[model samples]
Target: MFEYQLGIDFAKTLDKNDPLALYRNQFHIPKDDTGNDLIYLCGNSLGLQPKTTKQYVNQELEDWATLGVEGHTEARHPWLPYHEFLTESMAKVVGAKPIEVVVMNTLTANLHFMMVSFYQPTPQRYKILIEADAFPSDKYAVESQLRHHGYDDKEAVILWKARKGEELLRYEDLEQILENHGHEIALIMIGGVNYYTGQYFNLKQITNLGHKYGCKVGFDCAHGAGNVALNLHDSGADFAVWCTYKYLNSGPGSLAGAFVHERHAHSKTLNRFTGWWSHNKQTRFKMRDAFDQLPGAEGWQLSNPPILSMAAIRASLDMFNQVGIEKLIEKSKMLTGYFEFLINALKNEHIKIITPKNQEERGCQLSIQVKTADRSLHEKLTNAGIICDWREPDVIRCAPAPLYNTYQDVYNMVEKLKNILNE
Candidate 1:
């Protein structure tokens, strides 16, 4: 466990000793009107751009301008198999095999596509299970799927909710829900990391329980991808999906990733929505050839991906490859632990941390529930040049990203919070 200390000097000392400290310079930190750096603690929402992202994107633009249609096969990186460049690195980030991982459609789109194959509902087992506070897009997609299948959304959606007075979800509660209604559930879809509370659920445990009940299980890993070691393959999940714009540091609305367990990689019989890109590459160019599905996760592709957005993803993944997820997570635990310690030091009655205190149970995000606090407080923080995420009602989510955020940044942010609370 990390032993954290108070005072600005301690924060600076930690930053000096941090092996990943130099990485902060690799990102383009946001600046104020006077050009001073803002204390950015919003990686859970959107990660900052890497300095090299521009160069990476420009290369694609240059190739497109020069090669025209020939860029598909003859450009520097070769656009025809562009997504292949990201497979190995992305697989490493999400802890899956190359055959099991693919970078493709947006987060919700991929979720729907995976559902096409995995959420095969029967009259006897037609329910879909998800956390009560699953991300809105996931909830919407699943609800739409149920409606399309002729099931009432309200009747078919099962919520695994937190207790009346508690904020964090318990595994026992999930077990109880499954015990009673597992037979009726055709699919158990959950967030690998709860977006609101930063709770990192045990994916393997959830998958095991769902499979035991004869249900297909998958995860929406939007908040967990680069922030945690997901190990999607080892979890034995049927599938998983995540966006690149968040912790992955890709540009806004960038392409997303999907994972299918290798066991299902070659299942040509699995029902799915396919297009020309999903066909065998060799026969894909043969316009008159019959549809021969490409094996593995690549079979999910609908159309050729945008190479510029992919360039941004490549820039971020290259950094992840150099640093390694293990090292980043090690620093994450320490940085987040230190942030927690400093916040608790305030000893204020109104402030309570809703996110789990256990390093193993949560990521870098700490959801601070300030009693009676309102949007005015959020406005104050913004005016003070602190960029944090303000969820509706009363939560301030701050994530000190391990790649670029420093210990001093955490200290400064807490100091600003303390001053605001004092007022």
Candidate 2:
């Protein structure tokens, strides 16, 4: 257990000794009117921009101006194959193979695309499963897919819910659901990390259970991509999708990523939406040739991507490549553990942390469940210049991202929260 202490000096000491502390300077932390850096504990919503993002994006802009259409094949980072440049780094972030990973459409779009191939339903097996409180977009995408497949969304969607009066989901309940209804379930689509409660599910275990029941499995790793060691390949999931804008330090609404396990890399028989980019690159320019599909996840690309957004992703990923996900995860555990300690020390009756107590079950985010069920607490936090987010109804989510957040940041945030609560 981490022996966390309650003091500004202790927090400073931890920061001084931290190996990843230097990485904080690489990001652009927002400041208040008084010019002090705000305690920006909201990487879960959107990561802070990297210091190099402007330089990376400007290079593409300059190339586009100078070379026009020639930028596609002759720019410093050729636009035609630009997404390929991100494949290796992105694959490493998610523990996927290069062939299994592709940077592509936004999160929900890729989820729908993956479902096109993976969520094949039959007369007997037409149900799709997801978390009860899944992010609204995932729920919408899956419900639409069920309707598109000619099934009643209400009847065909099975939700793995948390037990009554409890905040976290149980694996045993999931096992029972599959035991009783897995035969009818066509696909198991879950969030690799629960967005609201900050629970990181065991992907490998979920995949194993789903496959044992003859169901294909997939995950929306939007919250897990750069924050955890997803190991999507080893998890044996049929597919996964994640956005680059959160915990990735990519710009707002940046392109997302898709992962198709190596097992399906060459599965040409899989039905999918495709375009010119999906055709074999060597023969891509030969426009009238037969459609020879690219061998792997690259086959899912629908169009050539926006280079500026990708440039931001490339800039951020280069930092990830330097620090390595392992070190990030290691620091994440300790930093969040320290935050947990401080929150618990408050002994404030109005507050309760709904996220899991187990370190391995969550990322840096802590879902602070306000007993009052009002936005006042979140407003107070914002007024205090702490940039966390408030989920509807009752929760205030604070994510002390290890990449840029420091021990002192955590300490000050908690101290400020204590002051707010005492008032």
lDDT of 1 by residue, 177-257 (tens): 999999999999999999999999999999999999999999999999999989999999999999999999998889999
- Please give each candidate's TM-score: 0.99, 0.99
Q: Candidate 2 lDDT, tens digit per residue, 315-361?
A: 99999999999999999999999999999999989889999998889
lDDT of each: 0.95, 0.94
lDDT of 2: 0.94
Which segments of model 1 are wrong by more than 4 Å?
none
